[model samples]
Target: MHRGRLFRPTVFIIISCILFLQGLSAAPPLQTGSFIRDAEIEATLHEYITPLFRVAKLDPKSLNLYVIVNPEINASASIRYSIFINTGLLLESKTPEQVIGVLAHETGHIAGGHISRTEGAMGKATLAAMAAMALGTAAAIASNSSDAAMASILGGMSMAQGIVFHYSRGQEGTADSSGVHYLDDLKWSSRGLLEFMQMLEKQEYLSPDQQDVYMRTHPFSRDRVDFLKQHLKNSPYANNRLPQDFYEKYDRMIAKLSAYLEPPGKTLLTYRATDQSVKARYARAIAFYRENNFPEASKQLDGLIHEFPRDPYFHEIKGQFMFEQGRLDDALTSYKQAIEIKPDAPLIHLAYAQTLIEKNQPKMDKEAIHELRNVLKDEEENSFAWRLLAIAYGRGGNLGMSSLALAEEALANDKPKIALTQSKRSQYHLKSGPDKLRAADIQSLAERLVKEKE
Candidate 1:
């Protein structure tokens, strides 16, 4: 989705709205933090959890999933109906079922209402603390590159570590049971969950610092392992096999992550040229690109495109490689191909819009603006898209709309002062209209938020 390697983490924060609107229909304050945003990976996650959510009688749309950029093997559910899964957990998982097991467990917590009961007493304090940290994270994101923002963002994560949803031992046991039950109801094996717990059991004797973040937060026990063991023995679906397509997708996901997250040299070594499997070729292509061996990367990617023309990800990654190398025309062609295959992916749309904007053709600015608006319709809080939209409007010679777009960008990035200034500027430059009226609303909201923070 970004200009970075495919499946790699891009640092960005979604900060809280400081004040909740007063009304019966007032929505809960959105949580704040840094995380990866990849359309392909997110779609895969949603696919894995859909049935789990359905079996648990929870609405999939009501729950949000975030892939935290941390390397700790952890997944946590917040009382606000969000699940945060660390990148380490995704990469470390050997099978889709293992990851599904974890999601099922988290869904158990959500369905059992464990999060609120455990976190209710500390809700206000946790919310206030995370909101305070949001300003620093947002500032770091605004001022730094992805790599530079890692430390500050992780520091922000550490500030709220182990406090958000520290479930009790009893709750953990209940979640285990519920998780396996959901898997069983779907006729999927819970063996993965049992295997995962057994792996955690070995860490029980390790010192606190030596244990994984999940162990520290989830409070693993031998009893939990035993519960899973006994359940597997009794459950009829314990040995059920997942679809072949699941493994294929899971393997590709892992290969893509390794190629992006691991060192280029390491990925090349792991997936050598002698290996011609789809996963190997995918990894090697990314590794070659990362190593700046464009010829080899091109060969691999071109082969992939020929072999699997319908696979949008291959085209998407090829587009990213071209986009990074400043081949706007080539990138645009690849991105358009990807979009044709997968029309609803917002990240791909964001990249396509970015490519159009970078072309700097006056005629193309309108097309860029159209793509950006569609992206915003899907992801209204995407500050990066808003920033691009501002640039597109500026290039189109629309100063008032450009200023209004900057106001929206600043608002999404939690820069109240900038939003206040830009909104006022937009109001002055534009004639009375819906957009000008929207600027007035932003100015009012920004004014209130600024005053409250002070």
Candidate 2:
């Protein structure tokens, strides 16, 4: 259950000993990436759990929910009330109703104050609460804003204090009841929940890492299913429930992403030379692209575009293929088509703008900057867009704005290409108008950061 990393959550002290024996780092980078395009799962959880919250006499409106793209099978209430689901669990779960069950259980953890009890009263502990300190909280903390809240969190500082786990038998029973009630309200079957619990209980017999991802953090047992079954048998709903759509979109996402995990040669072999199968053809296209078979990849994309016709993702892939071939104009056109179909998708706009910058066309400079600015609004931290925006501004003769954008890039990464661009632009504008000032600004910004880090 713990292989995905960071395993010492008070109840997981046993798992930690297993981790130590296995020679794995106790911590891994806290991930913030995930399947952001389709948020159906998170939104569904929010909708289904609302009734359960009311039944349990808790305010559902105040809690924030987030779907984080983590490979581990665990959910946690962050420092605040944000309920986070690892994308891995969503992709791996065999049934949609089972996911809803997981959501209900996590919500129970929240209402029961698992995170808050561990991390004393802070502000409105939102997933964004850490970042909110820089940008004021949308709502301040209610009762736990006092200093005593701080003491409680400090006491549970190590997260291994047996005192921190508040999920007693009573809370667990209540959570099961609320989960079944929520399922009944939605008219969806609750059998998936019990089945999932059974799987985790089986994992308890295996090695720690061999444990089902949920049990490491969720902690399961035989009693959980007994309680769930008791509720199921006692209810009139035992014979009544709605059919759930188990063909979850996340599964499709995983399938598409798996196109990357396959070996370049093996994936290519999976594709038929003919073009009937889009999925296989896509794997072939990816294989070729990774292998630097740009011309072949482009040809494959053309065939895919004709077959799928309306899939914007293929167009975006075509744009990438062209971009790598240095066919800037063609790449720009491909990306523009993708943007037309999915206008709100920032990656398409960013890709288009990046190609335009690479093209270094004077006429495209303004359009490139405009597109990048729009992308930044939705993705303030997209380092790639910042780099391209700097190029666009520099090409447009707006050296100051270019330098600011470059500064953002420098803040993101110290890629030599960006550094070289800044250096050259600074040289060209030395002691001149805004260019000189912009150059000086960039030099100061980059140098200051490097010095501070030193």
Candidate 3:
């Protein structure tokens, strides 16, 4: 949905409140860190987790999977069936199976309702700690000994840990058992889980602070590794190997991530011409694009498309490159080819819509609006698409719809004040129908946020 940028790295944390419990004034904010919305990576991950979701009796479509641009080896499930995986974990994993195993563990947390239950427990402890800290600080001000005052503050903080640590450990154990079951049901080996834990076992030698973020969050133990090993011994698919295509997709995912995240020189050096593997060539092509060597980039991509004619991702990347180079007609052709190959890819549709808008022909504006609306039907949270929809509506002279789109875009981008303004503007132009009602609702929410700030 993002326009004019291949990789839009968000600068701020996205805070969303999902209210689960009844009669609560406020719920804890689910902080989804900066996300990368690469079409190929997202499509590959969706394929990988679909079977796990089915095994766990959970609906995959209801879950929002976010890839955090963190280098930490960690993943977590939040209360709203949201799974967050670090890019570092994906990059560091030696194989797709390792990443899948981690995903299984996180899915276990969601299926078991551990995130909500743990949040309830943690919430109580956090409130108690906050109260204690206030009381402790007051006592410290009244006390003469500074050392004794500091001890009092630390004691209050440790009390919160006491309330949550044991419960967290139990949840970890449950998730581990459930994850193994999910893997077993899907006829996949549990060895990957054990191997990941074995890596964690080495972290045991380090102090808690020195351990990897995964160890700190997931709380790995020798007993958990032993459990996985025992399960693998009895599993029918203990020695099963994943399909070669899965490995190729994994390689492509890693190559794309590295080419985008690392320096161009580093990518080129790592993926040398001597290594003519598809992934290596793909990475080198991206590196060339980053260095603005358009001819080399296009030549490499054209070769790839010739070899893998039906690969929608290659076409998507080609479209992106052409768009960046201001070759509008060529970009449109590539985007249409990608959409034809992968009709269900929302990101491709979004990219095509962006290209249509850029073309700026009167007829293309309507088509752009149609494409943007199609994407929003499946991806309502995409702020970039909403923004583009606003622009398209404006170009078509539908000021009411344009203002409404802007309002929604502002809300999605966490700008409540702008949303309020746009909503009011929309109400002035829109008829007294569902659209006006929706505008009123947005106005109310934005007003609430403004009042809270005041």
lDDT of 2 by residue, 48-94 (tens): 56765675566776555555445656665643345656666765677
Which of candidates 1 and 2 is the stronger one according to lDDT?
A: 1
Write down the lDDT that model 2 would get. 0.54
221-281 per-residue lDDT for model 3 (tens digits): 7788888888888889999877678899999999988787667789999999899899998
- Cα lDDT listed for each candidate: 0.74, 0.54, 0.72
Go through the candidates in order and give the clash count of each: 0, 2, 0
Q: Which ranges of candidate 1 are over 4 A from the true structure?
A: 1-34, 116-164
Model 3: ten consecutive residues of lowest lDDT: 18-27
lDDT of 3: 0.72
Candidate 1 structure quality by residue, lDDT tens digits, 343-367: 9988888778877877779888899
Runs off by more than 4 Å, candidate 3:
1-33, 116-167, 452-454
The positional error of residue 30 in candidate 1, measured at the CA in angstroms, is 25
